[model samples]
Target: MLSLLGLLCLLHGIWAAPGDLHSLCYDFTVIFKPVIQQWSCEVQGKVDEKSFLYYNCDIKEVKPSGLLGKEIQRTNTWEEQNEMLMDVIDVFKQQLPEVEPKNYTIRGPLTLQGRMSCQCEANGLSNGSWRFSFNGQIFLLFDSKKRKWTVVHSGARLMEKTWVNDRDVTEFFRKISVGDCRRWLENFLVHWDKMLETTGPPTVVPNAFHAKATTIGPRLWTLLVILTISVLLGT
Candidate 1:
């Protein structure tokens, strides 16, 4: 019974899709201080029922600067992403203090005009470049290497460039960018190129398993015991 309980606990924990948000629509409200402006960003995949593979990024209240109409820049180090996002937020708080919270919807990448650019390069080799635009409901992404426009929400390709979509693009993009459009664009291309070529979609082969086992073993045993005790007591 104890073993069964432990197994059940492990199963439950693992069944929650143990990663970030992928293939899901993400919406969040951010408070711009002082007068309190509520800015919301909604990122969803495709509008037309027929083509569900694409994505759109829309910001309400403000036109959003970094995402569109900025020169493309790349982060020198991966660790700097968080700092960059904080800077963007700080800028927003400083610039826009008191705008009423209103639902301003911008669709697709046609009417909206701006250039949010980022280049991913490593070892002095340029991997690719990315630009994002919004057309009321859809967020359009421009890929320099592919030299095409794609819906940012689509997953078949790593940002629509390669056949690798391991990480939750939306979640990762949000975390890395922190509502700053440029960093989001920059970080996506950076990680896509850095990981896709080297790591190649996380593996379970012994080497990978061994590394995870070392980190996860202690936690698993503790969880097993806790589950067993909790279940036996019917608590």
Candidate 2:
């Protein structure tokens, strides 16, 4: 019985999905504050002095209504990806907080304003040399040399590859840039790039999530066994 209880405890602990929102708030809200505000846009949920914190944030839009504008443009360091993803998602939830959060889609070779992208407009808007316009999209790029995940505009390009290595990074881009439209993206990447050290890439697990499930097999059997022992001993 004791052995069974120990095993149950271990399994239960292992099965449980641990969370540290406070830690998240500390790392993202404090350390990566600028990153989120820089990449993403904000949609205020009734702004006031009291609700200032909850007013606007970098997050995936709640729906068609919350769409701010679109992922206009950007670039990022090849090394600093994990920090980018965690920070971006934290901001996304600030606006679209949900129980079972479903991550948005990511595509590659995505030509912004090109006929390829699902949300691409007929007349693609173009920056100096980056993407055009894509709203409510998320892009993810993996650098084999750097071993990091980078988030950027939906149709961003590097190495002259149209969509070969690049994936859609709309929301990830949105989570960082909010109000300052004139922010120099290349300068930002240069500043953040200094912190990059050689590190393995982060693994992305899709669909499969760690959720709580009731483990009653042992509990139920234990009760029966205990009852049986009592009855047998009494008899």
Candidate 3:
């Protein structure tokens, strides 16, 4: 379960983004409990808050979506992105046992979800973060710039300590967040720019306009909202 402090922090983090920033994020979920069936993993990639690709571990394939997906597939980084996601699956499998809650008496279904994001501001500044949640409760956060982990829940303290002590794991997280993710974001931005140019600028409505916009909400916001509701429902 997420601590009160952790919930507040999560809410604050999601709403603190700048107006002119662009972000690329990868969200992955791993199922761990209800042990009668095979465990599964699913990954989704979003650019500028829209999903462009999906990877299912069972199928071991990357599936692209829409015109943006078609454009991304033509890039050199497409293969690299596939390989990186596969690596993420392997890392999650290896670390799941270590991060599992040891003292929780209630047992049913359990899940581990990770979201890694790279954000670029209009002025060319870039940064990234990695967040992990267990059973829909945010438990850990990694700041790429600081190369440090913050444990959001008390149950996750040991997991944080263990990961911090592992030099290889620490470096792997740092490299992926600050290096690979940022590079991939930059590459995707080039394609996104072209797509925007071809489509023209988005139509804007004045504040006085009462008509509802058709714009889709961000994937991160939807996920976080669902998680928050689940927490409130005590499910």
lDDT per residue (tens digit) for residues 1-235 in model 3? 4433233334433333334467888999988665564578999998877788988877888998776777788899999989889888788778876777778566666678899998876444677899988888899999988997999989887678778898898888788888888788767654544555444434543332212321323444446545774675485
lDDT of each structure? 0.31, 0.26, 0.72
lDDT of 1 by residue, 62-180 (tens): 22123211111233432353344333344323322222212333221112222223322222122233334323233345444444456654421322332123234333333332233
- Runs in model 1 deviating more than 4 A are 1-30, 33-76, 98-115, 119-194, 197-235
Write candidate 2's Cα lDDT for 1-235 as tens digits: 3222223223323323442000001011211122233333332111001111121234432321121111111233322422443444453444222111133243222111211111111122111111222232434333322334454643333322433333444323333332111122222212221211211111322223432132234345345445644554466
Off by over 4 Å in 3: 1-18, 197-199, 205-235
Q: TM-score for candidate 1, please give it.
A: 0.22
Model 1 weakest lDDT span, ten residues long: 45-54
**In model 1, what lDDT does residue 185 have?**
35
What is the overall TM-score of model 2 with all chains considered together?
Answer: 0.17
Off by over 4 Å in 2: 1-40, 43-134, 142-154, 158-235
- The model with the greater TM-score, 2 or 3, is 3
Q: What is the Cα-based TM-score of model 3?
A: 0.75
TM-score order, best first, reads: 3, 1, 2
Candidate 1 global Cα RMSD: 18.7
